[model samples]
Target: MTSWLKAAAFGVGGIAVAGLATLVAFQERLVYVPVLPGLPRAYPVTPSRFEIDYEDVWLRSSDGVRLHAWFLKHSPPVAGPTILFFQENAGNIGHRLDFVRMMMQRLHCNVFMLSYRGYGASDGHPSQPGITIDAQAALDHLSERGDVDTSRIVVFGRSLGGAVGSVLAFNNPDKVSALILENTFTSILDMTGVMLPFLRFFIGGSASNGPKILNFLVRSPWSTVDVVGKIKQPILFLSGLQDELVPPLHMRLLYEKAAEKNTKCLFVGFPDGMHMDTWYSGGDRYWRTVQLFLEQNVPRMIDGKLSSKDEDEDDGRDCLQRL
Candidate 1:
């Protein structure tokens, strides 16, 4: 072979090798692992200085899938909807035990939180589909409980949980009295790309999207515009100016897309609030916003009991608008 031809061949081979290496290493988001296809897991539930209080509960999904959940009850039941707390993507419900403790102290209702299939003691691996099924299983479990008021049940999810909650609330509109989304993006894809200005372009590539490739990191099942419109339930969205996981503007876009003009859609954007703890750091205003929402939307019936469901004020639409 000629010297120039040989050099050209070597160059092409080097490019091929580099590209293949990049493809293999980043194809599944490098370090991001799917929580599903995994087995039973557990994490420590750390409370605040008060030793975050909670009750251990186990429930099975429809497919006989077992899930671990934490039920945080408020003493002296007040007339309000029971909160089914769906958390963000992280270790487990145990990680947010401190937040649960604060919820119990502030809100005058019950709070139950469960881990996705792979996190905590919940059985089965986690996937977008798996989490949806498990959420339904959670709803089923709550429905069977004699103490739970079906009409006054509230579905609350933060970040990734918002996608899960939106799907559940959309399907069973009648079942969900209201919805509360905190630091939640419109969809997983939106969460990873659209909301992330710096890394938005990396959705199709890797090494750039380190831990967001395979772990339910595709098109998210939750479409806030669709879900919020279909369900007549009251909705409240909370977000922070500095929530890195699920950017603040995304929350604003979600608010604008909501169809109902007077959907009772409220936003509580804290000037200095952090991600999940916007409520924690915002102090009285944060808790009051939530309390006021629950008070207005999930007010008592003639018997004085539980019932029903943010952020900025940005006016815009999401890509889902095309859908």
Candidate 2:
């Protein structure tokens, strides 16, 4: 090759190497967004504001990382089904109080939601392995609680939380009664290409034949697709067709895989629902779908039928409005 061409080629190669190194070194920052812009780590609101009975909880992960959570109860003796919520990547569990309140009001089930290690009041940085440990700790805590019914534990996760919840359910099939995944991607390996289209060229083929180094650079490959097939529990997939972050196709892939193993696999797609606004856009239909799924799969749980009273009572008012 000519001298000028060779220099240009060398420069491009060096830049590519540097870019790959940067991604490998700091990829966690991009994956786990504990705090969004203008959103503080401190909770903006809590279940108490909505008059919902809740307890501030702290549990230690297997690695001894302190994790923060809120255990919300329907009435008193928390004997029926429980919904273990796993939040999206951008914020802490506190941001989901409204959803928790609605679930309790409509479903009459206990809710347990925890901030993974490194998010909110939880200790340590978030990584795939570390968050996995954190999820296990949360489940262990629930299992130990006398108020919780270990048999009817339903795991509900959104976005990145879906991947985390999937891992937890795959690991403990007997412990989890059902799983709900919303706007979740198939895997970090798949999401890398979706978020960064150029990477598709380098990581398209099968694992055995694909560029091994490019795959290695994916620090946190929370491969939900790899484990959903192994989860024998009932699973409900909520996909927002208009989800800008995670394409609706990802949810389809997960549903297909899970259906192969579990007959109770259900998929619901919202035509106008976006990544973060599916609950809002889906209106009563979204909640009804969830209620029906839970009722059908998880026997003896409190009725979650979305009634007009449930709609008029708290649905209209913001959770921040304390009565």
Candidate 3:
């Protein structure tokens, strides 16, 4: 009996070691879920339904990867504030048409939705650095456009996109006027622990040791907490109170960190909101909050003259007033 028990223990130990090794080897696969080409019913809606004119744009990343994006222009001749929207991880740009339509029609702004490499019609594989490079390319595309007012550009990212947008806004403060993050987390390691606390024991030394091992293995840190302090632009954090995928506490913590820099910031929470349903759940209030944020942060050309103070200099009192 003693000999049999020892053999079983050895087998269990070997299985655990193999599991850890496999996790480290294929960690990127766990992070990025790209939908390959030739999937049926990819796009559910048409741009014409929103009465917006859109063109298919292909952007080349700094690393020579080609990215696909939709450049949707407002019906008006002179475009308003342009939004460079970064979507959540799971779907292509077509999956977010409703949200884009709302932004264009209700907010009266042009919207640019970018698909990370390896998703949709874009080329190359998706990685932390690769997606960030794709985001920068999207911003550059907007900046070079004659119709867009580069001074009034806003970087709006949701979930995973929030991390990308924060990084972009932090790196290019002069170019991006404001940032809007929805249902974003602090970091992948932190989120992993939150979502799967039991895995911490396997990944780390023990409960006391925490998730140090998991953090070391994670290739895409995408740590928004580290970058939020560096972002000087006005920021708006949208949180869903009942978010199951990413807890609402993450947004609150990010808000606290961003507020530390004396930057203009707003946090809106939906009591019954889920991960991607904040906009629909908040309804009209959601649109109003977004419009208010833009009005406060993004400058407008009034009578062919720039209105409002410089974006970086604004105290964000406008945000407080609305709150």
Q: Pick the candidate with the highest lDDT.
A: 2
Q: Write the per-residue lDDT of candidate 3 for residues 1-323, one digit (tens) a residue.
A: 69989999989788767766766787676677666346642544557666669998998999999888888988775557989999887767787888888878789998888889987778988899999889999998889988888899999999999999999999898999999999998877676566446455534321124537556676887888778877899999989899989878889988998899845888888788899888988888788788888877786988887676665754546544554
Model 1 CA lDDT for position 82: 81
User: TM-score of each candidate?
Assistant: 0.74, 0.86, 0.86
Alpha-carbon runs more than 4 Å astray in model 1? 1-41, 46-55, 194-226, 260-262, 304-323
Worst 10 residues of 2 by lDDT: 314-323
The clash tally of candidate 1 reads: 13
Clashes of 3: 0
lDDT of 2: 0.83
In candidate 1 the C-alpha lDDT for residue 213 amounts to 39
The segments of candidate 3 whose C-alpha lies over 4 angstroms from its true place after superposition are 1-19, 36-46, 49-51, 201-211, 303-323
Question: Whose lDDT is higher: candidate 1's or candidate 3's?
Answer: 3
lDDT (Cα, 0-100) at 123 in candidate 2: 89
How does candidate 1 score on lDDT?
A: 0.67
lDDT by residue for model 1 (251-306), tens: 78777766455356777688887776787777877776777777667766755643
Better of 2 and 3 by lDDT: 2
In candidate 3, which residue pairs get closer than 3 Å at backbone N, Cα or C atoms, i.e. clash?
Answer: none
